[model samples]
Target: MTSHWPQPPTFRAPIQPRQAGARNGRFELALSRHGARTHIGRQYVSYPFHMTRPFAFDVAIPSLLTVYQQSSSGGLYRDDRLDSRIDVGAGAAGHITTQAATVVHDCHGQPAHQTTEIVLEEGAFLALTPDPLVLFPGAACSSVIQARLAPGTVLLLSDAFALHDPEGRGRPFERLEAKVDIRDAGGRLLVRDNLEIGGAHLSSAGSPIGDWKVVSNFMLVGAPDRLPTADELAVLGRPERQVVGITLLPNGAGWGVRCLAADAIAARVIAEKLFVLAVSAAFGQQPAPRRK
Candidate 1:
């Protein structure tokens, strides 16, 4: 044995097999409308706005979502996954929904990543108000949203999150990385937001981007010429359990309303209120309620 070659590093297999949840996934939604248009501003500029038109798309399943995974028998496995993309074309309007909250299993050995892409054509409008994506105690994940808007399209975007312990007590952990990239028809970068939260970033002294509680962001685009005023924002009157901020984006001259809340419901409630106030002031028309 003394003269034998090295023992290939004791070749011991992993103490436990990787989790069976190691699966790839994708969900896609496309949009196109038949007929609809709304006038833009007092300058007499008019653009096609279809709030009720729906888009055309194909889904492998009957529902608006899809998933893949294998239950872990040993309870010590890692899952690798992705949430494909949602594409919207010019003159398309559609609503995409997930049957249940998207969950990222505990990353015993690897991290989970998801990406979302959205596109709008000239004179198009798209609203993303999907149900909140929930994360488990030990799970890890990241999501990204990229949108390309045509010359004069309007957009309403929002996101919400909530976390609790087994006893229903508010318990928050984990990290969140959110970024938004908006581009013009010529592919020019308009504005980008890079937001990160988790770990030591939860302290009150952390950068203004995040704190120890849940956070929500809502962006609304009106006619290229109309921008909401401070008086319009005052209509919100400060929501409970939230610190709200409002501003007009330098890019596309869009208006944005942001909030940090204690839970998902609170965040959504605050977001809806802002949506109503802004939509009315900007377009002089009330937006429809989001369908579950």
Candidate 2:
């Protein structure tokens, strides 16, 4: 006698490009799974400044335009990889912003894992900041980011998120686990951050997030000693009606700032100030106004 059983369905990651009316930027990519490993198979990226074949790792040069990116599939899945490489100035004065709105869909009580890696080389001055990640109700996600930078690199890196319930129902998200690690050229760790939030903790009064609907973290990595001092950074981060704090990274590698606000705009304002200060300190000059 022989028994019959249904096999699991194979999953294919889809890439969607938004309309060009929004901005002159878009990315189309596909992901395939081989056993436990995920590979970035095909990709097509367009920017106003230049066009080139998408490689697993390469520098991203953007002109004086805002690069807008979105996922057509709406969300990520289990064991997905999102790797990117960006070079801001490249050798001349370059000013560009890439805004990524990463949305994770509900997984039917199962959690999905995604890995992201970014590299910013020397002589690059970039504001690699993404809009807050919006987690839908009942969605569970785990994300990790690794950034490698050179000594002369000036960067304003930000990570933030907010919860959402579009259906008007009060259901909370399942869980969000995230971590960020920054390393120097010699593979030495400069900063490490970890965050975890679940449904139960959301209802707890003692939750670390406490009533703050929007949380943003900004880190300035470059010439460590040239950055602002602890006392100066503290003064620069202070703002009304918001909780903000700044600290120095280990071994004088850089500085990190954490801000919590009642809304996204407020958080962005705080981040902007920090970005300006960091850029001025790193390059000894004010950066071109980030018009978006």
Candidate 3:
């Protein structure tokens, strides 16, 4: 006799590359759970370009399924066996980019937590530039990220978010907390960044975000020689209609850029310039055109 227990969900077919429509500049995948394990479903892409030879890597979605369900108390947990690790640059020269979007359907003021970990082997290059997270009104979320890079590895990571009120109501999100930690292969901490904001603070005139509806932080970690000169970085850090700043990472490892903008377009404009400048400075060539 076979005992009856709920079996984990399995992919019905082999994973395949998805072609994002011509209008959508970026590829996107919804988050879901397979049994007790959470998977981004099998979605991957490979591109050969002039940057550091040709390489390939998989993009994993890191959010939990509860986020999509209509529940009063949303829950979020990391599947250590799976969600905790992302591997990049397995063969030849490669680059991996991961994009994530957060959609809150009926959170009802429930709070959620998410954590992600990334590891890059020596000589591997990774760019984790997810689209801006859109937090609906009544959302209270916290996100944590940990990344470990080998000595010779290069990394470009970006995290950005925007608040939204779909019903045309003026209500703001409840709160948001974000933290990012970067370390070397030996577990030595290189940089730590944190952001916490509440609805009240967001309305304050002197708030750090000021009139900006979106905020973004971009960090590049690699050897000193891979970073741009101070003057070049300074010039790239300036953006009209937005507040932006750039600073070198500790111990000459790399640099970071922080920007605040009134809208998503403004933020992307600043990011595009910074990304191009960084790629040119580190790789000696412009990056392949990234879809909007």
Candidate 4:
């Protein structure tokens, strides 16, 4: 497969053996601040992965670099595996996102898997927000995130998923499983979040999701003094189109929010609100709206 990314500053490939027809791939990047701008110091992206040049569009955080990741493949299939890693150096700022939602097609009995690892140095701030994964009928997928952050590091991260049926039928996806684990610089696990939903559950009477079509989890990880209070977070959502609740992470990594929305737009609105709040807390000013 061809890659769309600009030539990397530093690139290399390992000598790992591969199996025929295997779609396994991985990409790693390290970002650091130079003067007032953040730039990628190193990168290694393999097949099925492509990304656009970094853009600094947020006037409020001019140093913030934004990268849009893409996959050459149309969507995930049976036995597909993808892994990616990101490192933010001290004092660096960056945001990583996808151009569109990733579609997970029917995998029958073999599910697709994706894992991401992120590292943040002291004083670094990064936003990891990607479009939700859309699961088609009979699709099954598993996703996981592992983050190791220094004490002063800050992160505004989000995870979300939605279901779809392309044949005009009301069938739900087989299942979707997701997990997020946060750890300190010393590799001590602070907290973990797990989610699993089966399509059959949604079709049953008294479904836990009710009428909601999207599920989202947002986290603001940083020093305790920089997090919002429970009362402040309780006022984050409205009575229309969604439901949300926020509370301090019991292990004190930061704050965690659980949001359920009728659609992607509603979920996105809540995510943005959390971004704004987190930015104001970390940057000491209101951030300019990020234009998608």
Candidate 5:
């Protein structure tokens, strides 16, 4: 395990007979520029993980690759230790999104753990915008997303989650522990965001999420020229049940966004809007629509 990843509690998983980094469930992807377009240079995928063939559908940015990640298992299970990694070689550009939202089912008495690692070499660009995690009642999860970026690289990463009780019992998830860590290629830490919330606390008196059902954070790390301008961001107006906060990142690396939505649909709009705006600013043209 890396120094930043906290150790997981011991438990038994009946689904996969392996730990993280083992051959059973871990998936890894590496991409690099091949001539004028980016291609998957290396890949290894195991059970529960699959991906579509790379597509260069964006006419405005024909060289950029797009992929949809998929999970075959219906949902997360108790004591699941899933690991995934992606590497963007120098000068490669790509966008990756999930086929749909992931459901974090009840973990029984053990917590499910997931770790994601992303590395971007110089001049590489990557955008990762996945649907939110739907936390079911009694769901306990620990999620860590770590990124290492070299100089001249650009990254747009978003994370979001929402609560759901399939039985309509009004029960919330047991616990959710999430962390996002970003570092430079030299191993210097850039930013770290940590959040731990219990499901019960979400329903107490005067809850912050009184009406909102989803919360998300979107981060952009890149040169100023590649960031979104104030004018292009005007589309993010004050909606009826939405709240957003935007701030510049350290050393002007880029900007960060925190948004709250009444539902998952609203959160998706915010993420998609920001991606389009930033892409236009960086590449000088709006990308062709990526239909959901």
Candidate 6:
């Protein structure tokens, strides 16, 4: 019998865009005043931002306003996978949104994972307002965001997810897990939200861990003395479609809002509206519009 040789260990990789220009396996978006220049794979993307002060330009490709889908997958964890990360430095202000909904096809055999990490420096403003992340049947994915903020900076962030049938029939059972950790410049955890949803944990006839159709977490960080008032709470807590709760932090780090909805779109829309209200309240004015 012939001897079998052991195979070498190989590092799992991120999904490459169908087009070109990508950096470090992700559609790298380095914060810039004139929006962000996207790197498809190795080549620099052609799209450029318009530019808005107080609000820097954002980078998303295949942008909804521009290109199509960025990458294609073979299946799931087996081969085809979509993964990305964005790094925002101090004094940067911008919003990162996807061109459209991010849909993950069912992996017949292997589960796929999509991950994003956004790191913000002091005095930075980030609004991650992309479309909902849709997971088809048999899609298994996990995402994480590690945000490091400065003393006087403001961070506006949210995460939304949904699961539907890959065959286009209707909704199917799926598992979506997400985690967000906001830490100070010193690497201390200021706030943490961990959400895990799946067949077992999701309530059907008698489950208890989760019973809502969709769930989301929205966070805003600013100076403590400049918090929202009772009137502001009345306006924010008044969503006709979903249940939302807003609470101020005792340590002055910021405020937290958690909402659960029956659909992902509703969750996203609420998150954006809440962000706008929270920012306006925190800054004493309408936040700057995102530039090119």
Query: TM-score per candidate, in order?
Result: 0.66, 0.68, 0.67, 0.89, 0.89, 0.66
lDDT (CA) per prediction: 0.51, 0.57, 0.55, 0.79, 0.80, 0.52
Tens digit of lDDT per residue, candidate 5, span 5-88?
Answer: 222343333464444432236879899997888899999887788887888878768658888878988777767778989999
Q: Quote model 6's TM-score.
A: 0.66
Residue 244 local lDDT, model 2 = 83
Residue-level lDDT of model 1, residues 1-292, one tens digit each, is 0112112222222456545646555545454444442221111101110122232322221111111111222221244545545455555433343333344445643555556677767655555655454655554456677777776566667765544344454333355456677777777877676655552233335434344255566667635643456676656524557777776676554766766775666666676676566445534555565533
Among residues 3 or more apart in sequence or in different chains, the pairs in candidate 4 whose N, CA or C atoms overlap within 3 Å are none
Q: How accurate is candidate 5 locally (lDDT)?
A: 0.80
Output the lDDT of residue 209, model 3.
64
> Which segments of candidate 2 are over 4 A away from where they belong?
1-66, 73-81, 87-101, 110-113, 236-240, 288-292
Question: Can you give the lDDT of residue 18 in candidate 1?
Answer: 48
Model 3 alpha-carbon drift over 4 Å, by segment: 1-84, 90-101, 104-106, 204-206, 237-239
Query: Model 6: which ten-residue window has the lowest total lDDT?
Result: 60-69
lDDT of 4: 0.79
lDDT tens digits by residue: candidate 2, 1-292: 0101121232233544432232323344333333332333445654322333322211222222233343444555433344344433232222224344566656555555655555555554455566777777767777677777676766667777777778867577677777878787789887777766675556355656777777777777776555766766776533454698766667776777877787767767776677667656755655554543
Question: lDDT score of model 2?
Answer: 0.57
Give the higher-lDDT candidate: 2 or 5: 5
Is 3 or 6 the stronger prediction by lDDT?
A: 3
Give stretches of model 6 more than 4 Å off: 1-24, 32-83, 166-171, 207-212, 225-233, 237-240, 247-251, 287-292
- Stretches of candidate 4 off by over 4 Å are 1-20
Model 1 alpha-carbon miss at residue 163, Å: 3.1
Q: Give the TM-score of candidate 1.
A: 0.66
Over the stretch 1-292, how does candidate 6's per-residue lDDT look in tens digits? 0111122232233554332221123444555332433222212222221111222222222111112223343223322334455555555554555555666555443445555666666555566765566667656566666777766666766666555565665444445556777778888878776666663334245543244555556666665544455466556533556677776643566767767676665675576677556556544555433322
True lDDT of residue 134, candidate 1: 60
lDDT of 3 by residue, 181-226 (tens): 8888899988887766675456455555666788788888876676
